[model samples]
Target: MTRIDSLRAGDPPRIGGYELAGRIGEGGQGSVFLATAPSGDQVAIKLLGSALTGGDDDPGPGFARESEILRRVAPFCTAQVIESGLLEDRPYIVSEYIDGPTLQQVVEGEGPLEGARLRRLAVGTLTALTAIHRAGVVHRDFKPSNVLLGRDGPRVIDFGIARALDAVATGSGVVGTPPYMAPEQLEGAQVEPPADLFAWGSTMVFAATGRPPFGMDSLPAIVNRILHRDPDLGLLRGDLRDLVAECLSKDAARRPTAGEALMRLLGARDRPVGFLLSAGSAAASGSPAPPHIPDSGDAPALSPGASRPPPGAGARSRARRRAAILGAGVTVALASGALVHALTRDGAPARPEATGPARPLPEVTSVPPPATTELRLPGLGTTLHENPGDTARMVSFMYDSKGGSNHYARVRGTNRFEAVAPWQEPLPSPDGTWLALLPWLKESTPQPYDFVRLVHVPSGREYIVRLTDKPLQNFNPAWSPDGTRLLLTTFDLSSGSRTPVGFAIVDAAAAKATLVRADTSGAPAAAPFAWSPGEPAVALPFGAGPRAGLRFFDLNGRTLRTADGVGEAAASESPFAPAGKRFATGCPGAFASVCVWDTATGRALARFRVPAQSAFIGWYNDAHVLLTDKSADPHKVVVMDMKGEVLRVLAEIPREEPGENRGTFLFHYMRWS
Candidate 1:
């Protein structure tokens, strides 16, 4: 064991063949020291605290666990663990010294980040978590202080208390900071990956507002607020509000998984609309464009009216026109100059079109005929597919203009849409009343890191379903026809390349998930995997390559069967139809064609050729599928039946501005009881 007295400042002790310079920081468990290697490179060495070292019993097991966890995660998502050993009655671990300040220090020094910068921080941190969770460990303590804002990107550190799947039984204690702990952890319940998500969410709040969601005060008060109160997200913008809200959920199961959180952040940053101008144009000395204008075709143009009278009918009219032109030009010139100045001051490249006039709105397309139309819910901003019983409704995952995580919802009657709580993955339930959400986890932790959450729409209740102990990324959740079981896909990166890890079934009501089968073959490109509604099996199209084919797997991670003759084809993005009698898959071209498959016999049923340059496919009833083609001069939404017959042309929703590409419109699924 290493002696504590020898770790004092100015004591030149050789460790790992490096001379320790001085103590940098001391904590409850260890003291960090600035050291120089044989090559003179700087590194930080942590020695166990004297409290634990002074005990008669050996405290090497804890250090051994930390070293093993670090070694397991180093290949995937952490700073390299240089060396670890024992010396003079104390054990020590040495790691490369990260130069950047901790996230806590950065936030304290710079206040809070806003706009694009905040979003970037959230994305970067979540990406780190994604890498960490893929390695099958749960980071027991994740907070701003443990994250390093390095020049390359964010790096997750301090995995001294991380727990692996096979080791969680031996790891249970109040190990993390109370304010950042998940509700379950605060309540003394067994913690899981979602606990890390809670910490991440609180950490983000600190990064954005320079204050934790639970407020900084006594530990008891902070823990109390974290357990019961909701986070105030008024200060966040873009997708951050939703992302942080999901993270700070009192119910740990409601938070999004790291992978899903990363995707939501990406979607918010890559929104369809351009950057919005600030509200006051005069204050900034610029002409702000109108937010939106209604389209009015064939309306009589209004005449230009002015107060000053002209000198003559000929000369006066000429002079008035000249004055009008000059006035418009001057406005444009001033605005352009201001914009250029602002860009230059911010060190941003100036746009050539900054001086141009705002473009006119595009002509509105003719409204499509209402075919079996149901109630319209514009307040929801997206349409919903009502269930056959009218007891539940289904809507697609959509985002609010302010940065918020996208989630699906189910509504009944005229009631407000209640968000599905637990499943952060954003996959809908078969009955369309609940959704599966993957709560976010910390990076720099080991795996099997899977957690599933279920949301009850009408009541807004969240259910936490513990799935596995191994740190694996789970997604694309689908409910079986009987509604007794839920099917999902897992992606494992433990062996290097991302492989088709496996599929599993969870008893939805009991909150028990069991692995059915796992693919031991080489890594496959991640795609949507669906369970046939009528059969007790699932189909995963391995894409076009050597391992390309529609492979079938039972619930136990075993490939029960395989089919040879589907040619080499890629899978589709949309979900499969009910009963799995017929499903749609994407095809290469300007538009994605539909390839129908017979689930019973595992054969091709029929091929529906879509309109050229189409993008998305939606089911209108069971017989007709809706296709939207935005690539043409006048975009169109065509309804095609299974016989390859074009039944009708729906009213086109016109593009907001000319030359703008709307791509495909999403028609949400709803059912009426």
Candidate 2:
């Protein structure tokens, strides 16, 4: 009776000698149902869905062989297999029903588990794994979704993909969730009992933190973290943390065996333990980490005008700065010279306790004290400068080096300094706290997947903004001036054609996106997009196409206006000015000049001619702009006035002629406050 859904239409009332009661769950393998056996005992029935058939004429002799191996597994901390047979030519396996919810369900509904409960889960699953391994079977997929919280104790279930020890142990194909898979499994190396131990460690981390240890960012990012970066085990303290870390070791040979891990868990306890609570009995829990939106299903509606500040926003700002280290590379100084902390736990300090009754305000303060202003800077190539100057402390930029292309960010003075996912471009939020990334995949062909990945730099929390049920391809992610929202263009690929569908506005904090479906027939392949600096309107190349100039649209995707006077432009810098009164773009003509346009009327404001070699980088301020002066001898980042005047130089760049600083982009990209 633990969280069972009623049987749906077309579901058989009776299979073999068992009567179906209700639905337990459905997954990649098949649907599971709660049923009563011939002996009138409660049992769980699994309708086979995997391709494990030996021949078409038979209902999978492989199923029988696999079920025999599963039956050899001791019932200790495992679901005991009762029977296996072909019912109506569909392969099925029956096992003793464990009345409980999955660990994944518990964590998602409640939060993370801690202390003794956490220890018990770790112990129980390891016990089940030990038995499975001793029986010569390797549970290939041992994630949170597999561990069931039964009334007796935690029981491991669904070994549909398990392979016997003597079977073909290695294959080119990889099966299992990306985040929970071990390094060897990902590399297509020989997977053994050690891989299960690694999964156990990952599950333990997920149980304690309510997040995958490597983070649930992207398939590429998760694979990168699993292979390279150390896990972000949030607040998993003491001896348990050490054991889990050892289990998660990248080297599979170094990871303890299932039996060895069981011994470690059992031997560590100094106090006697009683029975653990069933999933239905345990109360929901919460973590000290920042609240995260669920990954699946529709996200909660975002509150209007509600803003979530980045971590370490208040008094703990300095502490967070001290802990800002690159993900896996050279450390950078945030405060003075301190090691960067992992993005595992909340860096915010504990709130102070109330001393006594509240006191009345003495008098009206002169004016509220100004907010704290911290220094910030960007890392050019492998080196980072501590002097932030007057630039915004939170900034995201890309630099290419011998190590390859990487995206770096300085949030509240901390840098996601290491290239978590190499060759990816990250667009920083206006405040420089959150980052919107289009995670790069090394696939042979273009994918139809459409979703924007957002990461809170301070806390290392990640969320996805999904707009549609159908597959899509998103491009041009532009953050609003306030950093609370994002504007992106969506493409439909249902007909195997990449057709321009419409645009979407994503609520960053809420992890929710609204699709403004449109008929973009005349839009260019790559159109320039931007959110209005003042109002909620967005300018995009709509159905009328680039010939229509900048077409403005509201949240409902209604066309507000079309400024044809702006004309067709090839934008090389940010289109909108900081003050929102004026915008700039590279003029489309043989002369190639930087043209300023009025935002309200879209009329030409001013034109500043530039050297053909020099390119418009971005707006320096409302009155000035920045240009990359490659025409200069040393190559400089120069500031320019609205008029055709070079005001001052910002930074002089060292030229890489041929043999010098190969594969390094030093000071090639720059941004200011």
Q: Could you say which candidate leads in lDDT?
A: 2
TM-score between candidate 1 and the true structure? 0.51
Which of the numbered candidates is closest to the native, going by highest TM-score?
1
**75-176: candidate 1 lDDT, tens digit per residue:** 223555677766555667777776677788888988887643465567667766766665566776888888876643466776644342122223345667
What is candidate 2's local distance difference test score?
0.57
Q: Give the range of the ten consecutive residues with the poorest summed lDDT in model 2.
A: 331-340
> Candidate 1: deviation at residue 481, Å?
1.7
| Model 2 C-alpha lDDT per residue in residues 23-93, reported as the tens digit of each score | 98887656789999878899999885534332245544655777777888777578878887766545677
lDDT of the candidates, in the order given: 0.49, 0.57
What candidate 2 gets wrong by more than 4 Å, as runs, is: 1-394, 400-402, 411-424, 442-449, 456-460, 467-471, 491-500, 541-548, 572-574, 632-635, 652-673
